[model samples]
Target: MSEGNKNTNTEPWGGFDDNLIQRGGSAVIDMENMDDTSGSSFEDVGEMHQRMKDEEEVTAEAAATEEEGGEDGEFLGMKGIKGQLGRQVADEVWRAGKRQASKAFNLYANIDILRPYFDVEPIQVRNRLIESLIPVRMINFPQKVAGELYGPMMLVFTLVAILLHGMKTSGTVIREGTLMGTAIGTCFGYWLGVSSFIYFLAYLCNAQITMLQMLSLLGYGLFSHCVVLFVTYSVHFHSLFYLLWLVFGGLSTLRMVAVLISRTVGQTPRLILCGTLAALHMLFLLYLHFAYHKIVEGILDTLEGPNVPPIQRVARDLPNAITVLNATGKALAAGADAILTQ
Candidate 1:
């Protein structure tokens, strides 16, 4: 009882004290390992930031180099050989356009170039006029004599004036504005359009003639129209008008054909060209004759009074059956009005 009792009192807590001491030592070692891991993680983060900064500097240097190289070497957002080629093509197009514009300006703005074509002698004009009137006379005439623009321009203007005067004198119910416009348009349109057509044909036929030459010849040809207009308006005879128109029209056609044929070489070509020209001239003349005659007939009807019988009007050789009906209708209307008033 003495030895066992003494041992129990000395070691009352025994293994529990040993377990507490060992746990405390293990916790301290775990805390030191955590501190070391945290320090290493911080160092890795700093290294990553430095690597990003270096990459950013490299990218900035590349961008600066491209900008400096592009300043003197780019065109329209293109680069290198392609850009240089584009610039050259653009320059060539610009130069070509500039040259064309300059040529057009010189052609239109300079009046002196046209002066030579208009400087014609009165005797020359008279001779050309005579030749245009008589187809036979133009046979031996010099081709150079038909190169004046003044005579043609004057003749066209004169024809217009004469036509207007005839319309006024006829007392026809035509608007002056409309009549003047029509006369000017018909005369000038025929002159320009036909002359251009003939010139094109001549070119096709290999005839060495200029545009101004064709214009001059066609312009002078208007003298026949002036003569026909003057005589028909003065006489007021339907038969006389037709006679003059046929004769003068044939003469003009023959004259034009002769001149055109002289420019050509081959017999078959000349014949074909002359035939075509004759047909064209005759058709043009016929159109003009019909137009003027219609006006003249209107004037005659106005002067003769509304009571003139339809049969008598028909006997006046009205060109259109519709014109006869119009006259008959007008006469009937007048009679009906008279009967109503009475």
Candidate 2:
């Protein structure tokens, strides 16, 4: 056997490798490197195993060090610092936790005490107020234009509405002056149609709306019409005026849609409404045309009189003038097209 193997098989205490050791010197240690006062010894294998176990315990201690130990349980606190610094951090964490718990307990106690007297309905109202203030969606560029125009347009409408109210309340009509009423109604309708068309155009471009926005337009028109009718005796207080304006504007938009959706499979609800309104308006206008023919003829006779004001006569003749203009324009367009084709 070699010297190294001989050392492995024998002990300094006169035992073979298989012999059980006495507690005194069974632990074989490297005395030069070891603490000499403790009477400790180590066998080569035993020393290695003990060193491994010590190392494992130190690793475990380091892992556990992150959590601060308390009587109740382990708390997630500064376990990173060493010695006194770690203890200080642990103390601060414990204090903060206690403070937070006490505050929470107090809050709960107060809520419980007030629960019986609390009115939930008011809470709902407050919530609704907050929700209303929180903007649902932003208004785009076109909607901004609509908002800017809405104010002045509304003022005009309010004046008209006031005039209408006055006429309805007065319940008086001049003789052979019924045509004047028809003319006024028609003009009001035309103005309303222009305003509505512009408003709707803006809304369409923006592709957004709110109930408030709709109401703003309606209110303005109502107020404007009221002012116009109440301040002047101009037999123009016709509700149909505003109705036709809304109807015609809607029809114009519908016509535009029809052009775009010619090949599409379905009609929108707006298209249906527009079609219905246009049909009804046309029928109603036809009925009025026949009904007021005699009154209109009488008004035309007055227009022939030299004493009649040019403005009054112009107002009387305007409807027929518009019809002529429309026909003339269409004919001119057709003529131009024919000349081009040739």
Candidate 3:
């Protein structure tokens, strides 16, 4: 019996000699330590080590998949891990949105223009754009955007106004290419006058002013001209339209003088000197009117239509208007007579 017990002690726990199994000289089994093949355990340690190694490999693969943000996280019940990763993705999306908003802001520069060109608010911009064409005290007004932006924009609008007026006067799509040339010439001529005035201000008054500010003011002054042009287009059929437009042009000229007086304040004989430059504005308007009318007449003559003198053309159309009025009156009178007979 003693010899049998000694043999049993030399072997593993095979239903006998239970001295706590003596795994690595430890009395207790650490199941957590089963992953380490260096340690020993009960129930076929070699086989358990092989199984643990396989389980560790599978755990490592699942961990790698989670780190890589693959589709395997849901299968492995690693939804909590994805929550941490979602923040990085959201940050990227937010940055992209900011880029798009910035681009959109640049494309629509006039969205905050607060008022239309012909608006009559109780108080205009503090720069006193309403009181004068361009207030010298623009340095006081706080703008959401740059002052430089408003100047070039005004010029662009002036160009558009010229194009519209030319199209209306020509009244033919066939002459669009020629009309475009005329429009460009008209704008160029107006700017040439403005440039000449700017040079005069420099020579006569020695006004310490920037050309950019003068350009900005001149462009703003052109807005009144644009409005007056629109009125002309609206009422051109009326004989007195030209006379009425000239009245508005005179008022626009005064506002331009105000713009110049504000700029050339320190110079002696300021009003007279400014007037010399300001007179150019009136001449510019007159030149535009005469040149525009002549161009329109020339275009009408060149066009493939009834070749007649402008006087003849109007004399011809005027009779038709009178004839239509007479016909309509006769038709109404006949209808009334028929009703009376009934």
CA lDDT scores, all candidates in order: 0.62, 0.38, 0.48
Q: Per-residue alpha-carbon lDDT of model 1 for 1-342, expressed as tens digits?
A: 222222322332211221221233244444543354454554667544543344344334433544666553222222222222333454466558769999999888888888988898899888888888776544344355357799999998998888777656643344445888877897889889988887888877776568888888778777877888888777777788778877887787777777776677777767766776677767776666555556555535544665554444433333343355447455445444545675
By TM-score rank, best first, the candidates go: 1, 3, 2
For each of the candidates, give the backbone clash count.
0, 31, 0
Query: Which parts of model 2 have CA positions greater than 4 angstroms off?
Result: 1-153, 156-208, 216-266, 276-297, 302-342
C-alpha TM-scores of all predictions: 0.56, 0.21, 0.40
Summarize candidate 2's per-residue lDDT along 136-168 as a digit string, tens digits: 233222222122223434444444444334333
Model 3, 91-130: lDDT tens digits are 3555577689888986687565633433433344335445
Query: Cα deviation of 239 in candidate 2 (Å)?
Result: 23
**Which of candidates 2 and 3 is the stronger one according to TM-score?**
3
Q: Ten residues in a row with the worst lDDT in model 3?
A: 14-23
> What overall lDDT, based on C-alpha atoms, would model 2 receive against the true structure?
0.38
Which clashing pairs does model 1 show? none
State the displacement of the C-alpha of residue 316, model 1, in Å, after optimal TM-score superposition: 22
Ranking by lDDT: 1, 3, 2
Show where candidate 1 strays beyond 4 Å. Answer: 1-109, 136-145, 171-177, 298-327, 330-342
**What is model 3's C-alpha RMSD?**
21.6
